[model samples]
Target: MKCIIGLGNPGKKYDRTRHNVGFMVIDELIQRHQWKLDKSKFKADYTIVQTENEKLMLVKPQTFMNLSGDAVRPLMDYYHIHLENILIIFDDLDLPIGKIRLRQKGGHGGHNGIRSIIEHVGSKDFKRVRIGIGRPDSSLSIIDYVLQTFPKRDTEEVMNSVNKAADACEAWVHKPFPEVMNEYNQ
Candidate 1:
């Protein structure tokens, strides 16, 4: 079985924020597959889908961002999922908007949620799909920028990124990681 964990804060207040890009992609995946994510399990909202030979768990951690590992570690343990079989979907402030990066293993690059997962999982060797949200202008605070919603002009870019990231995630699930990386990491 494979587990795809989307990192973000829960609640309506954080909805549509740049930091919630993970949630958006996961929602898109669920919607595209017609999967139901209403199950309250593993400290997250999850849905299970069986595709030929693969069993996939689509998860949104309810522990919010910083404490996301608390939900992930336990869920991974319970499902007997290895690091290689896990994928984390989250926003990346370093990349420009509308970009996508798929990586096999790496440090958190200063993302607290990713740092927490590394701490709990005891390794940096996990798969990840990072959607670019871009950095705020030099004059703006990081907090304010991440919490802010995308502008109307960037709506198409945001949606396109989400869709592509979702497609990359589905490909990652069924195909090899290198294949996904080649296809997504442009």
Candidate 2:
């Protein structure tokens, strides 16, 4: 089995914020598959779908961003899914908007959500899909920038990245991570 885990804060308040791009990708994938993350357990909303020869699980943890591992670790354990079989998607501060990057393994790069997952999962060796949100402007605090929704000027770019991120996820479901990374991490 494979798992696609999107890291984001839970609630309507954070819905369209830069920090919730991960959730947006999950939503896009869910919509494409005509599925819903209706099951709530391990502090996550998830759904499982079986394809011709494999199964895939779409998950959005409800433990919020910083405590994401509180849900991810248990869910992986319960499902007997290997760390290599999972891909984590989250926002990145280093890349410009409209870009998506994929990595087979890496550090959290100061993201609390990735930090928590690395701590709980006990390794930096895992798949990741990062949606670039860029750094905050000089006037805005980092936290404030991430919590705020995209302005009108950025809406088109953000939506494009979200769509590509979702496509990358579906690619992972069908092929290996390296090939999917090469295809999407342009």
Candidate 3:
């Protein structure tokens, strides 16, 4: 079994904010597969979808962004999923908007969501799909910036990246991380 986790704050107030790009990507995937993530447990809204060769648990953590691991750790344990079988999708302020990067393992790079997951999971060996949100202007505080919605002009671009991220995740179910990275990191 494989697990795909999307990190974001729960509630409608957070919808469409830059910080919720991870949730947006998961939404795209759910739509494409017609999978309903209606079940709630492990501090998350999740569902299990079967691919041709594997079962994937799609999780949207409800523990908010900073304390995401409160949800992920228990899900991992209950499902008997190893660190290597997990893929976390989240926003990245370090890269330009609309860009997506994949990595097999890495530090949190100052993301509170990733930090919590790392602390709870006890390893950084899982894969990550980072959807770029770009850093805000120097005058804008990071918190204010990420909590805001994307600019009107950038909305299309951001949504396109979300679709691409979902595609990359689907590819990941059948291919190795490196192969999926090479295909999607272009």
lDDT per residue (tens digit) for residues 1-186 in model 2: 999999899999999999999999999998887998989999999999997668999999999799999999999999999999999999999999999999999998999999999999999999999999999878999999999999889999999999999988888888888899889877
Please list the C-alpha lDDT of all candidates, in the order they appear.
0.90, 0.92, 0.94
> Model 1, 20-86: lDDT tens per residue?
9999999999888788887887678888889878999989999878888988998889889888899
Q: Which of 1 and 3 is the better model by TM-score?
A: 3
Model 1 quality (TM-score): 0.97
1-186: candidate 3 lDDT, tens digit per residue: 999998998999999999999999899898887899988998999999889999999999999899999999999899899999999999999989999999999999999999999999898888999999999877999999999999999998899899989999999999999999999988
Tell me the lDDT of candidate 3: 0.94
Candidate 2 stretches with Cα past 4 Å from truth are none
How close is each model in CA RMSD to the real structure?
Answer: 1.0, 0.8, 0.8
Best-fitting candidate, measured by lDDT?
3
TM-scores, all candidates, are 0.97, 0.98, 0.98
Compared with the true structure, model 3 gives a TM-score of 0.98
Rank by TM-score, highest first.
3, 2, 1
lDDT of 2 at 42: 93
Worst 10 residues of 3 by lDDT: 25-34
